[model samples]
Target: MSNLNKLDFTALEVSGRNYLKWVQDVKLHLTAKNLRPAIEEATDKPVGEAEKATAMIFIRRHIHDALQTEYLAEEDPRALWVALADRFDHQKDIFLPEARHDWQHLRFQDFKSVNEYNSEVCRIRSLLKFCNETLTEEDLLEKTYSTFSASNIVLQQQYRAQKFTKFSDLISVLLLAEKQNQLLMKNHQARPTGATDYDDGTRAMTGGSRNAFVELPACVIMVGIWVKDMTDGRKLDVMSLVSEDQHED
Candidate 1:
């Protein structure tokens, strides 16, 4: 790392189970510190003794305590790099086949949610990449479309019609659609049967110099009642009133 005083990632494990990832992290940190050349097999320019010591110290700082003692006498970072590689490079063979299997079986429709499906996709893709296998964007999109539930064939076709160039863009649309569906379901459950709409009338003023009498036509007034649930055995209540108005001459 640029600042060697701080550790950017976990130190290499003594068992070497994390060797591949640790190797990658080491290379990145060494590169950031401009000490990569000291550990490289072939370098266009010469590496100074002081630079080698610096690279050695950086590598030692990122290794397990047991490893530090195991390679305590090692002076050159390049030699230590080769020694570590020889000891743990077989991990590639150990993990590649499983990564391939996981990649082959990953599917979008198999997951309950888009997030879960996406997580699996990413995990498989990362493992494949670490094994030196490339999982292209087209492959990702096709995998999702082909694995769609049988009932969603039409929906899958609609998404394919969008001709998405990036997997992220397509997944974003899928996630948004999922959230909207959930909201609609929640609203439906909140009110199983819909409610009625009400329209209100406006008030007006009409008069002769001295207020006279007026007889309005018989009118119908509508009052709506809210019905919570029909299956709950609650009684519905409604009322209607009729009255006559008298005016003086």
Candidate 2:
């Protein structure tokens, strides 16, 4: 790729199928490059000619060849931005309803992981935002709370009891719990099975008991925090620890 093509985001296509995302990417990059004023209607201070020229070049580089040729006569970054918006801004009209449908059906329990759920929610939220629909923190929280799978009633109740006011706080807590649970699982897998601890800190394999498994009761809390039976949503207690002991002939 040419050095110009080595940009953070790909050039906007002529079809404008990805117009919404492309606009967002361009705005973010422009802000980062301190060229935002080049396209803005008003600025705290006058945007220098050199800055406007740089912004014009940047905007041109991130557009399709057809678009470049279409607006070759446009020298002003602000004018180019307005032209692009006017040409492809109709994408929101086509995407808003679809975004709403996805948002209405979004379920936290439907996803296998928190990260996936978070990503989907953010994507839909961005689309809604583009359509002038605001998704509040309360909306995010309610959507998450209401979508807990039937098997996770107890877990859902536990999270509700905490009364998380912000989506960020709730997601942060869930991510931490998941990380801790994964670490505990890694430690458990690394430990040898059928090895019991003695009073003097010695470990020995039980005789003729290959199926015997030791429970780290202290660490089970990590499992209880995140993992729940999809069958019953039952909070498995320390006393109800699951054993994966292997059987040997």
Candidate 3:
């Protein structure tokens, strides 16, 4: 009875297959203890006193409020189990379509991380499986790609080009790609403009060019304002000023 208390049971309600699964779990536990006869219809022989007591204990502990009032008066555990099944089994039909819609439309949102997104996908997959509608590996892969962030262009492209038989492999690649993206973003933010390495392995700006720009701290902003004033007041083209400056240099 102490061990039975530890066994998890989903509360029974008007809707969902969770109650059916919970009942099945309880039945298995009873079967393992050689006490299944307590909850099963008695044959030619009468049920033992111990079996009846065990079954009653189980029902009293696990039965939900929605079902308690109706089944509480019943002395036979097997009859009570059957009554609950007859009333709630039809709920699978109602839950199936809803689960299908939810699984089909499930997408990774910006606020969720990769693991969080994967957990939701797995959760919906489980619901679909319970409804006898399991998605194929290819279908799951496609759905995963479809829901992935549009910003993950490189990862998306790599996924398309690669040949991955297992969804786990794809997830591994995606996690690695996400980490690499984070690292690139961090490096980009930390690096100073003109300090970034060029294709030739040299800094973007030479030492002299860097010094010239640094010396004229407000030059770029001042030039932009001057150009706007000249353009509005004197009808001067911005390109002419640029060409004049280039020639002077």
Provide the TM-score for each candidate, comma-separated. Answer: 0.70, 0.70, 0.59
List the candidates ranked by lDDT, beginning with the highest: 2, 1, 3
The true-versus-predicted C-alpha distance at residue 198 of model 3, in Å, is 24
For all candidates, the clash counts are 0, 1, 0
Residue 180 of model 1 has an lDDT of 100
Which of the numbered candidates is closest to the native, going by highest lDDT?
2
Higher-scoring candidate on TM-score, 1 or 3: 1
Residues 128-212 of candidate 3 have per-residue lDDT tens digits of 6766788888877887777767787666667868867777788787778778989988977786654533323211223223332
lDDT of each prediction vs. the true structure?
Answer: 0.78, 0.81, 0.66
Question: What is the TM-score (0 to 1) of candidate 2?
Answer: 0.70
Residues 110-223, model 2: lDDT tens digits:
898899999999999989998899999999999999999999899889998999999999999889988999998997887564333341221223343422333443322222
